[model samples]
Target: MNSAPTNYKAARRDPHAVGTDSGKSTRGEVSLSSPDAMACLRRIAWLLFFTALTALGGVRPNSLQPPQQLIASYNDEQSATLRWEAVPGARLYRFQISEQRDFTTIRTDALLLPSKSWIRATIAGLEPGKMYWWRVQAIGNSGESAWSLPVRLSTNGEMVGVPVERLPADRSVLAFCSVLRFSWRACDGATSYRLQLSPSPTFDRQVIERESVEPYAEVVELVGGRGYYWRVQARRGSESGQWSPVQQFTLLSLANIADAAPSVKESQRLRLLKSDDPVPVELVPNPVADVLTVRTPPLHEGGSITLFDVVGRQMLRMPVAGVEQAQIPVGQLPAGSYTIVITTSQYQWVGTVEVLR
Candidate 1:
């Protein structure tokens, strides 16, 4: 009976049993399907996946760098120098100049050292009175940096000699109805000149004439017996640098021609009795066939008369007197409209006349 009891306890705690009272089992019989064990395995799997995602997020795709600094300085009136701070790992530096604010390839490019920090280059052939902009760009193996701020500079105009020596001499006056010949020494870099002639030394009224790159200009078709003043200025395209000292010249009297052509038959010619005074005028036989006649009140001595076409072309010039009548020849003139001008040294009278065939 005691042996049988022992057999029952042995069966309850068998070492090779599928399930045991002591909760100890063999490897194949172990209950690994418990909720707590399953939950622990899932947590391990999630940790491994999270670690892989974090490593990928931390890796940088590409590197980004900053732009370099630019500096510009003017060496002289016609020259400029450009410099820039060196950028580490830069392939090359591109320099650009532009007349406009926006940078473009149309502007001149000055290539600088790829890795060097300092570069000096002279900018020549620039126009005066013009503003220019410059900037630098840094290029590297990774990518190109942003462009630097633009630097602005202006060039000076061409220098001109002082006291413009080539100007016409003082008291050197030109005469009306005379071909005025003007010549002067060229300035150092002057390509051409702008010639202006007027009736006053101050150049209030200007007659413009342009000459070639040469230093001379011929002014013909001057109004006879009229006092005219003139001045000259130098130019290089839109740049009008400096004006010469105002030169004063009084147009010579029309009567001067009488000395040379005394043989020409002279009838009653119009003349201004006043040298530089205003006078009223009246015309008779204005539409006459053969002779045109004009009459004016007695005038001061030294007055003159001038005849011109509609286009201001001088046709005839004569002296004036306190005479009863002045006669003009119309036989040789073509049928058209003409202007009869009577002027004194200080006064002027203008009238229109029609010529009839």
Candidate 2:
């Protein structure tokens, strides 16, 4: 039989310490049935269970949430800005850029410390005209989170001499009209042009498309009360150049002219009129040559009269100065249909006039 432990205090503190009393195991052995010994064994078993659960994919706080809303915008032909929503409690972030969607190879791998709700990363040294993929991962005290969904972006191609839009200025607002005009500078070596209009900036869906030899085009009967985006592409034979930068405009209904026009007195003779309402202005000589005359009812306040070509390029602008009649010289202009915009203190009018040689 083994003797009783000599160091009772030490044995109570650590059951394993009881195996050797006075530095010799032959002196005494601890009783496993002791309350302290049983408590120590339970703690060891609990630690083992917890570690096994962790290795089996438990206690994953990072995987429950990750960065989101990844968006990329080109800063130039060789660089871009990547941004995304930050994850709460994230201490650091890992962002990667890759040429392959599956991320077989990484072009950029970087780490960042969380600072705000939105995180921004600027990446450079990219090749033009190539598509790239990017994603982000958040890391916290627990572990690293799953990667965010990737976003794809393309760099601008060789569009050095591409056409530039001239008319229907970007982000312009216009009143309700059946016809929409567009114009762009002519591109060299281009035999034809393609004009496209869409409700999306990405041009995923096009509502209007026209092919023309000239640099200008027109679309009619586009519904008002919405916004539209347009771009132009130059083509020569079978070759085509990249699309020009997009331009956007919003069209409002004539009844809501207050939004498009300056505020005017309600009692003025040139009161705001509905789209179907007729204006009191008239143009003499349907196909005008040399000189065109605009006749209208007497106006209490002066307004401006303007002429626009098929491409919505302004050809003439003059103040009516409260006059009932105004004359415009069309002899120097090219033969085509032009739009006339008459704006008074209280009303606005849009009409088409045919100019002759």
Candidate 3:
């Protein structure tokens, strides 16, 4: 009976020990479900959802803008027209023009309407021999876009006259000598024409010749078998046109003369040659008295002589109408050296004379 009671007490104690171990296991699992751990898991899930939304938004399609094609045309010597293709979403266009190649110095700017694809505006009062650059910019609701490719335009520097279709016939090559003749169509307002001969194209150090109310000019005494350049200008009062295009000619040797016998009379030929040569002047008595006599070689016709002081101040101007000699009254003149210049339709000559009395 004592052994049976002892076995039953041992069974009851074993059951109670099992119940305590189960309770400890439940508490351990509950501790892992703390507030901090749950909050961390919620934050991770929200971050992933936001990242997906942002990625999807970036892939949406946006409007595309491209540069427009431009076309340019010249309206006149100093003006031009600009046109371009229209942009679909553009509200306005900005136009810029410049004289420099890099567009650093802008000359003009205009804001144009978006509805029109072509615009005509005169670029007047522009200088000659200059190049211009132009471009267009499209403005949209979002922002201003890139500039169009630049277009280049050039203005005419040579001025053409009326009634002159072609230049005068080129001079014939004379044997043992070279002859160069220049001709041009006449301008409406020109009272005289000036011819310029130069070794360089710029004509900075030029030899000038003049003709009164004539359309043709002859240049003689040129070196044979040598190339010479020439240009022409028309003048009326203070207004003078731009220089014409340059022309080149070569002289022929005397052996190349077609006919040895002169077809043109000697007097006529001398007149023609003298018209292009510088005039010759002689002052009588190097040391002059109160009155001095000036003599010039006989001019063909329509020539003149002018006198100036040593300092290039004009002293006297007289017309030459079949007169070779003139008496210059220097009674009240200052005691100094003076220069006398003789100018013919085709020539200009200068000589110095002293006044000592």
List RMSD in Å for every model shown.
Answer: 35.2, 24.8, 34.5
- Model 2, 1-357: lDDT tens digits are 022221121112222222223332321234554655555665685477447646865656555376887755455666666667778767666777778999986655555556566666655566777887888888665656889888786664544356873556565555556656677778754556888998999989756899876778878847767788888888653357788888877766545543332323566544333335576677887689756778887655557766677766555555656577766655545789987777766666767789987
Candidate 2's TM-score: 0.32
Superposition error at 210 for model 3 (Å):
47
Candidate 3 lDDT tens digits, 298-334: 7657655555566555544445556677555443346
Could you tell me the lDDT of residue 115 within candidate 2? 57
The parts of candidate 1 lying over 4 Å away from their true place are 1-158, 173-178, 259-357
Q: Pairing residues by index, what is the TM-score of model 1? A: 0.29
Clash pairs of candidate 3? 164-185, 168-183, 175-253, 175-254, 176-253, 176-254, 275-346
Candidate 1 RMSD to the real structure: 35.2
In model 1, which range of ten residues has the least summed lDDT? 1-10
lDDT of 2: 0.64
lDDT (CA) per prediction? 0.53, 0.64, 0.51
lDDT of 2 at 163: 81
Best by lDDT: 2
Q: TM-score, each model?
A: 0.29, 0.32, 0.26
Tens digit per residue, CA lDDT, model 1, 237-302? 345667787765455466663342211124434444333535456666766554567787665667
- For candidate 3, give the lDDT: 0.51
Q: How many residue pairs clash in each candidate?
A: 12, 1, 7
Highest-scoring model, TM-score: 2
